[model samples]
Target: MSTAKDPGKGAEKAHGKPSAKTPAKPAEGLPAKILSKILPPAEAPKEPGEEEGEVPHRETAPAEHGPGPDLRRLTEIARALNSEPELRHLLDLILDRIVDITGAERAFLILRNPEGKLEVRASRSLDREEVKKPTAKVSRSILVQAEKSGRPVLTTNATQDPRFAGSDSVAYMKLRAVVCIPMIMRGRSVGLLYLDHRFEEGAFQGVDLGLLEAFGAQAAIALENARLLQENRVRQAELERSKEKVEELNRVLREKVRRQSAELDQVKQVLRERHGEMKLKYAYPEMIGRSRRHLDLLRLLDRVIDTQVTVLIHGESGSGKELVARAIHYQGARKDAPFVSENCSAIPETLLESELFGYMRGAFTGADRDRKGLFEQASGGTLFLDEIGDMPPEMQSKLLRVLESGKVRPVGGKDLISVNVRVLAASHQDLRKLVEAGRFREDLFYRLAVITVEVPPLRDRREDVPLLVERFLDAFAAESGGPRREVAEEAMALLSDYDWPGNVRELRNEVFRACALSEKVILTEILSPQIRERAVPRSLPARLDDRPLKDLVRDSVEFVERRAIQEALARTQWVKTETARILGISRPTLDAKIQQYGLEKQG
Candidate 1:
């Protein structure tokens, strides 16, 4: 039969060349006897029905052989290709089926790699086994032409075909009956299927070319699906790893927060204990007295210290209400902040509002600049309003508003300023009575009296007199740079017996006056006239005849001298030298007198 060629454009004649005398080796996995039945011999004669030198028409052959052996085989091979999901197995299956169906000595499946170079993916022979040195056995020129044109190329006698005469692979391999079909998918060529026979011309016909092209389409689709499935599995594995890492990080974060919360709680506990110790050490250091009334007042102060409640202190005018307020502030948590004191009765009614609540520069006359009120100045601390009962009715309303809101509006200012001050209000007058009389706001009284501290008068705690007298004596001596003076028994008795209406303040003034005027000892003659006049009279015997006149005179003198000497010795702490120096006597005389009086130092 004459050689035939399909070079993509149309079929053409291939000049006849004598077939090679050497027979090609049979493919592995298929016996030589079986291959002999599939492929025609090199010099086989034509069948009786076939005319000499006649080639089958490419389009007409398929219609005439409808549902014939070749079409049925193509369908079976396509089904097999689609069933296989692994690319490696599918590639080998495709090449094996092509060699079996085409009756070619070798078949190669060439595909594009990542860099777009064609590489043989699967190579096989008719024996259904992989072929060795597949690239060297195939015609490179035919594969490249089919891939570039996106069409199939067929040559019945490649050695004699002028179209591939210059091709080195074709010349070296003496390739014949070569067919290369481009696998096209989505209107683009993806790869090529190549088949070739070595000794036979016209081994692959135009009908086989058409069947292989259809098979190439099915193989391309199967390969793409396998690649996509593999990519999805890899992505799923990565997502699972990321999820585990996120869960681990969340667990670590929760553990960290729990530890920090526990540490914070421990620190707060330590601060509370230290705060209690501070209160005991610093509260009311200057309030010196051991009287029951004094001790009771201290206990009340202790309950209110370290708290932010408003306190109302009630006592007479000189009873040291401001002093109690200071103790509350200095002993509390706000000790480092300010302690401001304002006497409600001391400032004029017209100026009290500006003085306590501040004012803007242009708000009133003589207002040179803006000023902070007592409330603002005492922010985060304490504000002591003494004689609160005497505050004007208008100012009382404003003060009540500030106490309720914890904020204050300065006079002539538009904005209200917030404050953190703890209010401490004190009054000598009875506030409940003032409220009953409509002189004070009852609501404000309740707010300020969340706690109440009542200071005792000097008359009620008479036992504290001796202690107060000594404190005042030492203070005066320190201030005046002079020797300390002692009060005689008669003078002390007179002072203690008198009712000090002016409270501790009156006693302090009395002692200061006596110390300034007296030298060595304070006698009754130097005592305040009010104290002396109020003293209980020294009783005279019913009659002087009951005792001798000389003995009465001597006993009175010795009694005064003995009391004075004992007091001097006690002030010196029983030291004879110091006692004699204070008394202006020799040390020997002081010892002799101590023995004469039979006086011993009491523990």
Candidate 2:
């Protein structure tokens, strides 16, 4: 036998002799370069009967049979088995490698079941019909003995081998050669790698057994790794399914909560409407009255309540102008619709146009969305514009156009929207006087005054004072949770004769004060000084008796100053800022005078 050598280190030179020291790399066209790196190349093929020193000829393995596994091929088969991550493919690959590496005619990869039976996991050269055969029964006894011993077993001629002399399968199948290797993992034998040749004896060699045993060990590791991978994949799939189920449950709960919240909001809106109706019924219980003047006023309201007439109400400040407007709206045909009211004097002249006619989005700063004005909101209803005389001259022209055409143009809008609103205007100022003075438009006044309703002052309706007093006492008692205050005969007489500059509103305020300060009785002492002082004037002397002339003039001047300050305070409802404005004095001067006069607040 010749020794193996690296083919890349040229053994022969151009001179037809073997080179001694210089080593040249193999030609790039050669396939044996990879094999050279793993192991020495096999010795060149020798001719028949050649001597040991004779030069050998290069030859390839015959096509009819596979060659034994070289060192390079064994490593390649091991890498291929380890690379496969799936258990099924790896098993087949292991069996294919066994057949190629050992030059066997058939190969079988057998695994031990839990019951200790050898089952065929993968096989080459076995037909599908024959694959069902029991591996332990068909395999010679030597395979079992080798697996138990945890080593490889080889036979050149199994039928006649001493180790398997009486083996039934060896004798019946006439097997000539066989190689069996145990697949060991973690110090235990799990299965066997089996190979056999029936066509030729000695087809597998000792060197081939070593390669098969090495490949068997690698196959075991590969199979275990693939099993772990499959288990991990199954666990991830279960977790994903569980996560999806939780998300679906959360979405269902949120939708249920949203529906419940909507139901609660609808209930709240219904409660608010019920409360407003209750308040209106309690405050205006059949229009508290007992006089013919009050009866005539209600009759006038009845005639205009059913029509679409534009009614103008003329009354002094605090004279129930808004009350008359509310009575007309709540008793009218459009009572179910909105009864939107705006005080023209309360809003600035610059913002009055937008307040009455609405505006588009981005009409000015802070206007982020389109808004509906009082006119549009009061469609199919009544739009009560209080203090209409205080509306700017420029806005008056626009109001006239809207009232005439029954259409309103919103601020910065190109379209006109039709409105079916009934306008009710009120003011303390005389609109006809304002028109004559060039401060108000004549056309707008005519549009508003189609029907005129004048609310009488409290002085003209003295017969209604006792009824108004009883109503205010009961209303205030219920609101304050106290006993109703009874008015004394003298207090009632004093309140009746007083010229109420503030009208019924002032009388109600006086009664409310008495209810807070008195005990079960509205006495004369609890009445406002304006009402008390009115009674004193009826008894004033025309001439002083036994008094100095200078002293009388000074006392009269002091009395007149005190009375003037009291009237100014009552007009402003005791607000220092407004009282100072009406009295044409600074707030400091008004404060000094209020202290110096020793005036006590009654209402």
Candidate 3:
């Protein structure tokens, strides 16, 4: 239904109803008849004193072809453009204008398709069948003039023009004059708005073209916005996939650690039962020592196979507490299962629970879906909790429950699912003292203390210094694909002498430093200066010639190595983490060495 005033008013005025008269000049090439119908009728002079020469305002500028109407009309158009955001609503308004002004009896707004053909996007007095009939493509001839000239085009007869083929279905409705206005953007017309006159009284006037050109401009803007929005949506979807990959990486790291831990436990027990000289064949026992302190740790590992009780491994920060944990899990019954690990102190308390137990969909506003907690992901595997002392107090209760009941309850979920898993806990804190001071839970402490294994510091097992250094050098060479770098006998001795506060972790870093900066075969000033400058337990040798150079270097290296190992062990609780840190190796490496050296069986 038309919303504007009836066009019957035009007929009444033409039939000599006392309407106002107009005397406006039409633009070049515009028919004077167009100016007559579109311009407002001039009114009689109000009084003799009034300015008589002033031309009456032509709200619909039939002559100028400028923007039609005045501020109020433009404002209304702008409001409509703003209020109706959807493209469908905007299309409806445009087609209605074409039918009302250009006298199109039945009209449609066709859009270009992916194949570059026209398809009717919306219509007036038309259904999908009429649109999809395949003839809906506007005649190429009709589009040529306006597209080439960048102006309005008029066709007097539809049957004559080759664009609208005369067919039985199309012939039923009369199509006379077509007034096509180019839809222009960036000075180029992208599409067309067309109208037809089905009756003699409905011929298009110049004012109709002016109105259509403005509407066409508006329609183009709406369409461009819709296309850009779709592109952005596609890009956002791609970014989400990349985020999922990072989550996958984190999951894989935990799974690897769990599997290795369970395997170590198995290896530990097998050695005890067979006991043929109790010679251990840990992954990397070749480059090293023949010390009873070093070998005892391996013996203890053999005794503790099949035990899922808490194992609190203590050592200095650089000590291989984490390494021992790995060895225990990897060599144990859970070898086939996941060896998941959590760095208790890394994540904040606020996020720790959600990260550990997972969350339900809508657990919090931005959570779009439910997630599997880490505990569930590591079910039937060993969970290595590192930095256990640093865990938030609030989460401690939950940890205790899981250990006691072997079940995990994710946040925002009701079901308490049982997990067949072993817990391997490690920390640098003195849990006994912490418990006495009411800082740590005594009950939780007892549960984890079931099979406590103290790792001996590196200083106590000076016999392993030569072994650790040799292993580190080879490992670095293999991984870097670079020729192996070695330490001078003197540099080795100096390294072993310092009281290493940073422990085995410090040793690994120093070795990496030597590898990173070592230009010559032997790491000299670039490496030795660091170890040489630090305070040695014994005074510095006065001259290299005083003792056998090899012995002198070995003593220096062992002294520093022992001191560093001792510091790390104290920090970690006599854990092989000290050796792991000294060698700049992984916890699993240290664990394997701990068993090989038999440190676990040492007094």
Q: Of the candidates shown, which would achieve the greatest lDDT relative to the real structure? A: 1
* Per-residue lDDT of candidate 2, residues 154-212 (tens digit): 77778778778778878888888777788877777778877777788767643333345
Candidate 1 vs candidate 2: which has greater lDDT?
A: 1
Which structure is stronger by TM-score: 2 or 3?
Answer: 3
lDDT of candidate model 2 versus the reference = 0.70
- lDDT per model vs. reference: 0.73, 0.70, 0.61
Task: State TM-scores per candidate.
Answer: 0.44, 0.42, 0.43
Worst 10 residues of 1 by lDDT: 59-68
Local accuracy of candidate 3 as per-residue lDDT tens digits, 1-603: 111123454323332343243333323222222233333334222333435554332223133232224223434554565455566666777676456545565565667778876556766643212333424535445665566776666555565556456443334444555566676766655567755555653255434443455556655665566556656766777777777787787789788877888778557644553354455545323324444444566666666655767788776676677777777777787878888888888989888888878888888888889898778777877778888888777788888998889888878888888888777788888888888887788888888878877765665455465467667877888889998887765466556554556766677777777877885445447664656787355633323534577556654664444444444554566656565776687887555544443333212
User: Candidate 1: deviation at residue 247, Å?
Assistant: 72
User: TM-score of predicted model 1?
Assistant: 0.44
Which consecutive 10 residues in model 3 have the weakest lDDT in total?
Answer: 58-67
Give the 10-residue window scoring lowest on summed lDDT in candidate 2.
1-10
Query: Which stretches in model 3 have alpha-carbon errors above 4 Å?
Result: 1-276, 281-290, 528-530, 535-603
Considering every candidate listed, which one attains the maximal TM-score? 1
